[model samples]
Target: MSAKLYLYPGWLRLWHFSNAILCLILIVTGLSMQYTTQGDSMISFQLAVSLHNICGVIFVFNYVIYFIGNMVTTNGKFYWRNWGGFFKQAITQSRYYLYGNFKGESCPFQVNEEVKFNPLQKIAYVAIMYVMVPLVMLSGIAMLYPDIIIPELNGISGMFLTDLAHIISGFVISIFLLIHIYFCTFGTSATSNFKSIVSGYHD
Candidate 1:
């Protein structure tokens, strides 16, 4: 029998929704600023900058809450990698996604109280949350206060480097968001996982 479980708590729901909104805002404004010239932009360049910075600050605050919540709550357990047989588990999970699922085979990983993410998810989340997000935030901060927070190499200006880093990281995160959304649809139904985040239950 299929078991329904309380997978997402209220605080996590709040964080997830808030973060998603802020991310959407940031991505929109950021891309607007990057691609459009000042006079030809959809939103004014100044407005885009303002929106991006504001959303970025809010996103950082939300990220802090997410970090602290994970540290203090059971949610963190999902992210902790099981080093023992990690590669094997990851391979199995990858195979399921790439081949097994197409052949009508069952998934190798299942969600439960102690293990929320599969091996591949754990690795991807770790890299995204711990590495890419931090770098993006740091580079953004450097962009905001280029003089005070110089992140330069030998002779290159920190502002230029930081801008490049921020752009690349944001692109990577954007791609990840697409992939994440696609995978979320792979649940029991197309919207099951989406509904779970809203209602805090998973079946």
Candidate 2:
């Protein structure tokens, strides 16, 4: 039986929903800009640039709220768990993803009030949220204000390096978002996770 838990608060849900929309817009605009050549692109280069900048700025603020919310609320605890035995737990969870899940074996780690995320999920979330997101944001800021970037970074144009970093990190986040949506389908029912995000309860 699935236990119902009020895991997502109203503010958290709003942040998540807005974050999803902004990320989609940013990713689309980013791709348009990246692929533009001689004024040919999915979206006009000028419009793509404008939308990307607008959404990027909004994402910055939204990320700040997420960081602060994690710090000041219990939500942060899930991501802040001790790393002891993490590798072992991660391996077990990985095995489930690779083998056990296909065999209809129950998950090695189940969600509860104290531990809402499995080991691999927690690690991925930490790395993506704490590390990759910040990297992307900093590189994005540098691109927006070229004047801030040093003229040369290790004999290469700083702007080039900044753009590269931004692209790579953005790509990582885009991939994560896709995988996250796929994983959300794993629940009591195919739509249960989606409904939980809307109603702020996990079943």
Candidate 3:
């Protein structure tokens, strides 16, 4: 099999990993902050809340920077462009992962600048970044200012809704994180994808 070298690009790797770690920090700290435990603590409730907030701010910074900077790259186009093909690609890739790839077949979609994602990736990346990511951020931000939001929420309980939204969004992201890591192991060397993200070069 011939190998192609398309350097993953440094900024993309930096943003991806940094964003991931910060987000995970938020996830863990957010959970710890939410539940009031009277026992041993990974982090004190007060400290968890404070750390979560700080991590959140860092996450937001990374989020905005990446969104603006990589709007033209896989970070964006992987979701926005050739949307019809996205659905088709998703179906085919799904089949490959479920059955065909086990038989050692080549990937259904080619990887190139013009056609980057294999359907599954477009939907996953898009949903995570565009849909779910914003939802979590919004609800988390709202939770940060329940008093302010409560007044505006009027009649409806903002705390209940915001907490629900935050929990649901966090669940989705947690699942995405799990799946992301699993798929990363399915690459050529069982670590090619991880290496790609780290070194910005998939070999």
Winner by TM-score: 2
What TM-score fits each model? Answer: 0.95, 0.96, 0.90
Best-fitting candidate, scored by lDDT: 2
RMSD in Å for candidate 3, one decimal? 2.1
Error of 1 at 193 (Å): 0.6
Worst 10 residues of 3 by lDDT: 145-154
Report lDDT (CA) for all predictions: 0.87, 0.92, 0.79
Ordered from best to worst TM-score, the candidate numbers read: 2, 1, 3
Q: Please write out the lDDT profile of model 1 over residues 1-203, one tens digit for every residue.
A: 68888999999999999988888888899999889885767888888899999888888888899999999988887887465799999999999999999998877888877778888878888989988899898888777777775656788977787888999999898988898889898787789999999999986
Per-residue lDDT, model 2, residue 71, is 93
Per-candidate count of clashing residue pairs (backbone under 3 Å) = 0, 0, 1
Clashes of 3: 1
Query: Alpha carbon lDDT of residue 20, candidate 2?
Result: 96
